[model samples]
Target chain A: METVLRDAAAASRGAPLRALTVRVGPLSGVVVDSLRFAFESLAPGGPAEGARLVVEETKPAFRCPDCGTLYETPVGDYHCPACDSVRGELVAGNEMELLSIEV
Target chain B: MCESCGCGETNPHLHEHGHGHDHAHGHDHGHDHGHGHVIPVRSSALALNQRLADQNRGWFRAKGWTVYNLLSSPGSGKTALLERTLAAVPGSAALVGDLQTERDADRLRASGAPAVQITTGETCHLDAHMVAHALDKLPADGIRRLFIENVGNLVCPASFDLGEKVRVVLLSVTEGEDKPLKYPVIFREADLVLVTKTDLAAAVGFDRDAALANIRQVAPRAAILDVSAKTGAGLDAWYRWIEAPAS
Candidate 1:
């Protein structure tokens, strides 16, 4: 995290890096809040200091055909409450990426 | 400078003066001074791999193939069942994912079904990107059923979507009947719950009713099938269930 900030700052040449928003999915095994906390703590003294860190949470969407119900499951199960379809379609989740960086 | 201004000097008088300044400055200051070098960055940690996964799903869709993501714990008889299914049903091929080695895939090939082994290296689960890459490298000729036998770990595999038409969750009778109740979320997303290794049920003190009841308690509507890939006891039911029309 410090290295990331340092590299971002080093690349900026003290010009000022703006807001950095990150997309974190539940499946990525990264805790969004913890990452945000780390970023806040590490960003204060570096080029990321006061650099707006926006954390976007991504969740996996699942739909059960048997029950005709669509809902979001936690990082664990994908079962539908109305119908216990173990093989429902996973519409989303498993996302982690750098959306954009403002400098 | 410290001695001249009495700042952190060795004298008690200097300490007193420093304490006084600190106390005096404790009052609220209305002016707000923002810090410099704020990092303005928007990015996802999984952005790179997720892009690849999307492309993979698109590729599978373009080919008109129905992918089944098979998930279960180690020793849940996932590979064994696949072997039996291939033997029973003629038109199925598989891409088996594992941490290392093609042992499972090699065994599967004995059923006269072509299978590609996807070694995940150190990863616990088979993610979308790996499936996509494996699909590109596999022979996509005259195949109707495409099975993605995920690395055997219930926790991690539940989090990924490998673009499967069905995400089948396998449970062995010997593993305890409360498995589904304990892991409801995985069972919740399962299109079908297969209770495997039932041939050894009696020997292993496996309670069929208790397990079924537990699964029912969590996922009452899950299409449950009991089978022993060894004795071929209930595989026909499993095959029929898999071949059932997708509405």
Candidate 2:
């Protein structure tokens, strides 16, 4: 929970960290459940001890470069439904970001 | 769940037997609880690594070096290819990554090029920070070409940026033709796709056409090269691609 301690500068050093929320994108290659498991197993004896870990999944979003069509993959459908664009820029779903911490 | 902390507790972040506190950041003014607070971080987990990677990219560019990040499965002949490349090309250096041991680095150094080994312990992929640290250990200067042989994995290395001028993904002929389709993340990031072990293609019943088609399907933009490091068959073309600057 080094990230939690670093970001929890507002709280006292020994303040009991209550929770942690993180944003996980689809293309980030991180499993949400596994992340929670790791956090739970590692949080003890630290500032974030007994902290509840919350992981929010981001929908895989893609922006068509040619037709400017925005698409989301909730069902593993990556191709643009609006336009058949081969080169779609990833607008989201490629990040593993820490959102906030409560202490 | 409470909106502040996503904790089911009615008064989330509120301390039991609360006391008036002089905490840092002063962001606890609005909430019912005065002592507890939720700080918004809003930063990537890999922020430090990404920043270091950008710095490495800048430094390599300043030195006019063409660095290639080589990725493949274990036993895909990445070291063999590098051994040949270091022997074939002049002013080239390498950084080989492995879970343990410095054998790959020793083999590369024996190829008559300066090579450094980065033992990652238990890490599956080589992050930018590790490369920056290992770059310090490498002593050779005026390195025209720098090859960073990433840990032999198809999955994890795709997400880490190593500040390479280009990424070369190797798919050995012994590995099935559908590997590109299976590991699309790494295949899609390829600037060059090298089909290694061509000398054993026939003996291994490797379908060259199907493999080329699969590579084209996943990485249409990457320049495909069929190279047999054992026979030195396609080494000339790979060397040419190295010498020719990015277009």
Candidate 3:
């Protein structure tokens, strides 16, 4: 979470850290509540203290390499419905990122 | 102070933006100075770590070393596979990650490879920073291949990139065939899925076809190989894959 603080400060040109917007994907292995808890606990008396945090959750997006069909990976079914191509690239989601900071 | 929300006197921003109704014409300075605007970053939370990982990748590539990041659950036979690979290949080095034990590192060393143990303590995954620090501890200069045995985990480690040329996820036959289905994120990004401990498949009633189908579904692009450290089954093919320039 300090990474968010430090990066927000950097992005804001050394301005006092302010509210942050983060994107946490479902498959990012991060729990939003846990991240919020961490921020609340770790931000006191720091640059990000009292900073408003907005988390944007994203769904996983997969693109089939064979036919370029893009779809969400359905539960237990990974093969592309159109081409039967199992070689689908995960193009989105799986993201834990800092989207913006209000400084 | 030509005008614009008394901020024109102190705020450098408003002076440059006199484009009418820009909160102009002398207003109160009682409001928060740093309010109103949001800057978009749109960067990975691991951006710094990623930059470091990229450096490690380029460094390893420049040194002509093909690095592999090994991921799996605990008891997935990662150390066992590496022990065999290092013993057979001769010029391989390893960086082992565990919560606390140096046992994996010691075992690899005994197998005639320079190995460094990174005890991550509480960290579930090994990061590029740790890998960079461990690189100095091992004599990997002349080694052709470097294996990073990631801390035995299926989920957390998947998000951290270790700057490896190939990512190999091991699934021991003893570990249920539904592992890939259960942990699709890790398997989805794997380059090679080594189905280990094949010698015990029959005894364990491991469903080979189901496992293969699941692996293909999750990691169709990954080269799948069956290997057993105890019985040396399919090891020759494993070694060839490692040695193959096409990999």
Candidate 4:
């Protein structure tokens, strides 16, 4: 978030940040509530003061190596639902990115 | 707070293309206000940590050291297992992590292995930077086996990769048999699962079969080993497993 804010400040010639959008995935293992709390507590004193943080969580997704089927699971289970195989490779849900910033 | 470039300012100015933003991409220019534009900034939070971890992995490979990350909940006998392993295996070194103690490292050193304590202060887990810094304080040369005892916590330690050759997660019999099911994320990432404190399995009424079944469901790819560090039970097999060349 700080990185995004700095970039936004530079791009907009030091304009106050309005809002920041971030993406959090299930496999990232970061608590979204804690992230929002930390942002709220720390953003009050910086260039991001009074800025709103919008968190968008991405669901865990997996792909079957043998059958080529993409699917989503409840965080921990990696089994392929179509083939009943336990060898589904994770293809998504590990991302933690600052998507965009409004300044 | 950028560590890569020592800019005196707290906010490091990023390069125009640092985040790989492509202006050619589709943009909704409905708003005429130029003061606040939604800049597409796609940047990973863990990019720096992952890069450092890759560097640590390269360093370990160049040094010919087999590094194992040992993780488990508190009171899972991780230190005791390390003590037994160091006593049995020669040319072993350890980097122990804890919130506020040198006690585990002190005990491991007494077991005849050079050990260093990484006091994390209030950090819940050990990152790649901490392990890299601790490597400098210890006699890491010619060490065949490097054991990093992570801070005893199942949830946080599973997120940070310390660039270990293998991750070994421990589950004591004294804990519930459904530990693997309850903490599936850590088990899913474990290369090997050690069922420790086997001597007290019967006394504590620990369901061995149920525990193994749970582990199999969560971590089908992980090799499971049952060992008791107190009585030296199954230590030989564990030692051989560690010494065997990675497949």
Which regions of candidate 1 are displaced past 4 Å? A1-103, B1-32, B35-54, B217-221, B245-247
Candidate 3 residue pairs in backbone clash? B4-B24, B4-B25
Top candidate by TM-score: 4
**Native contacts conserved, per model:** 0.30, 0.51, 0.69, 0.61
DockQ in order: 0.16, 0.37, 0.45, 0.51
Q: State each model's CA lDDT, in order.
A: 0.69, 0.78, 0.81, 0.81
Question: Which has the higher TM-score value, candidate number 2 or candidate number 4?
Answer: 4
Higher-lDDT candidate of 2 and 3: 3
Ranked by DockQ, top first? 4, 3, 2, 1
Provide the lowest-lDDT 10-residue window in model 2 chain B. Answer: B11-20
Candidate 1 retains true contacts at a fraction of 0.30
- Across residues B125-223, which tens digit of lDDT does each residue of candidate 1 receive? 887656765665667687778888999886767766776778788999888878877766566567778899989898889988888777765554467
**TM-score versus the correct structure, for each prediction:** 0.65, 0.82, 0.83, 0.87
Runs off by more than 4 Å, candidate 3? A10-18, A63-65, A74-81, B1-36, B245-247
What TM-score would you give candidate 1 relative to the actual structure? 0.65
Q: How far out, in Å, is residue B208 in model 2? A: 3.2
Whole-structure CA lDDT of model 2: 0.78
- In model 4, the runs with Cα more than 4 Å from the true position are A1-14, B1-36, B245-247
Query: For model 4, what is the C-alpha lDDT against the true structure?
Result: 0.81
First chain TM-score for all predictions = 0.62, 0.82, 0.86, 0.84
What is the Å distance of residue B157 in model 2 from its true position?
1.7
What value does the lDDT take at residue B199 in candidate 4? 94
Query: B62-152 in candidate 4: lDDT tens per residue?
Result: 9988999999999999999999998889889999999998999999999988999999888889988778778888784658899999999
DockQ score, prediction 4:
0.51
